[model samples]
Target chain A: EPEVTQTPSHQVTQMGQEVILHCVPISNHLYFYWYRQILGQKVEFLVSFYNNEISEKSEIFDDQFSVERPDGSNFTLKIRSTKLEDSAMYFCASSEGTGRGGRPGELFFGEGSRLTVL
Target chain B: AQKVTQAQTEISVVEKEDVTLDCVYETRDTTYYLFWYKQPPSGELVFLIRRNSFDEQNEISGRYSWNFQKSTSSFNFTITASQVVDSAVYFCALSDFNRDDKIIFGKGTRLHILP
Candidate 1:
């Protein structure tokens, strides 16, 4: 089966450093998203991207966070300055657009990139 | 506001035991969707099932079954004759049909099937 893939299975960075996580979504999907989970907490929605722009974002996705579909296949998330609280597992997901052929809102998630900020 | 609540933090069951994971969700939208995902120790979110609000049907697939109740706003999953391979963190998620871009997930229930 085709799957979403994320790079940098694990990353460690110092506070105030820049970090970027990469993801390659399933080729035919039209909607993409980013979510994060603190070590032992629930997964939190960060942002959603479609049509080369952000569709929606949460409070957790503040000024420091940015997402880009730099190319047809690559979707990237960049954090300008990482903080200790930023340590978490970031997941990239994609889905076929809404209400297509009875399958609606089903997202395929990547293995996740674990970010550790010290 | 949409929220998914997986009240059971962790559960341990002996092999061959049947286990059920509880999930309660809150959503104001009349049209919405609920989902379940499994994350093994290897750390990948595997899609299990998706149920729309209109369909309150109970579905069974082999040893796995899902009960979706719109009246109580709950979507629960059950595993019969569980095996060690069933050990994983299970997450229940929700998304509004109108705003289908992002999904809200629960804290997840960690299942440990002991041999």
Candidate 2:
């Protein structure tokens, strides 16, 4: 089955540095999302994007985090300044749905990008 | 506010045993969908099942079954004759049908099956 793909399966960067995590969602999907999980922690929602605008976001997705679909296939999440708390495995997910409710969409997730900040 | 809770942090069973994982969720959206996923040691999230708000019908697929109760806000999963391969972290997720939002996950329940 076709699946979402993420680049740099693992990333290590210095604190206060900028890092851009890349993801290519499944083709023909309309919605995309970013989530992160610290070691042995629950996966936390970051942001959701649809139709070129951010549909919704969580507090974990603060000003330091931004997402853009710069191209047709690339969905990138950039952290302007990384912190120790930013170290986690980031996952990208996509879904196929157009309008509203009643179980219209199901999300498929990527393998995830492991980020380690020192 | 929406929160998905899986109280059982870890469960262990022998091979060929039947096990059930409990998941209770709290969501303001009366209309939503419930999902179950498995994450193995590889850190990959595997989709297992999805149940809509309107559908209270219980479903059974292979060795897996799900019980969706709107009254209790609980969606529980069962594995019959579980095997060693069934060992993994199971997560319960909820998604309000806004069409463009992401699914929120509960703290996963880790299952360990001994051979």
Candidate 3:
């Protein structure tokens, strides 16, 4: 089965540095999203992208956070400046389309990128 | 606002035994969706099933079954005669049709299958 693929399975970055997490969504997927989870914490939605624009974002998605679909196949999330609290597992998900979760391409998630900020 | 609660932080069961994980969700929207996903040690998510709030019909797929009761705001998953491979973290997520890609997930219930 086709699945969402993310690069840099694990990343170690210094505080105040910049990092970009990349994802290649399924070929036919239209909706893409970025979520993060701290160890032992619930998964939290950070941002959603569709039609080459941000559809929605959470409070955690501050000015320091930005998501872009630079090209047809690559979707990326850039952290302008990393903080200790920014360390978490970042997940990229894509859906062929959304039909209240019943439709065919219902949110397939990638393995996730473990970001460590020090 | 949406919140899903998997009250049972962890569960333990022996091989070939049955187990059920509870999921309670709170949402204000009338039209929403519920889903169950599994994450193994590899930290990869595996989609299990999806149930819409309007459709209360319970479903059973192979050894997995789901009970979606809107009255109680619960969507429980049951694994029958589970094997060691069934051990993993189970998460329940909630989303609404009105929204495009906003899904909220719970902390998840960790299942441990023993020999």
- The best candidate in terms of DockQ: 1
On the 0 to 100 scale, the lDDT of residue B84 in model 3 is 92
Question: Which candidate, 1 or 2, would have the higher DockQ against the true structure?
Answer: 1
Candidate 2 ranges beyond 4 A from true positions? A98-105
DockQ of each: 0.79, 0.61, 0.66
**Candidates by DockQ, descending order:** 1, 3, 2
Error of 1 at B49 (Å): 0.7
Clashing residue pairs for model 1: none
lDDT for each residue of candidate 3 in A1-118, tens digit (9 for 90 to 100): 7889998999999999999999999998888999998988888899988889998899999999999998899999999999999999999998877774436326789999999999
Taking all chains together, the TM-score of candidate 3 against the true structure is 0.97
Q: Give model 1's DockQ, 2 decimals.
A: 0.79
Residue-level lDDT of model 2, residues B1-115, one tens digit each, is 8889999999999999999999999988877878898988878788888888989999999999999999999999999999999999999998785643767899999999999
**What's the count of clashing pairs in each model shown?**
0, 0, 0
lDDT-wise, the better of 2 and 3 is: 3
Q: How well does chain A score by TM in each candidate? A: 0.96, 0.94, 0.94
* Model 2 residue A111 CA deviation in Å: 0.7
- Give the CAPRI class of candidate 1: medium
lDDT per prediction? 0.93, 0.89, 0.91
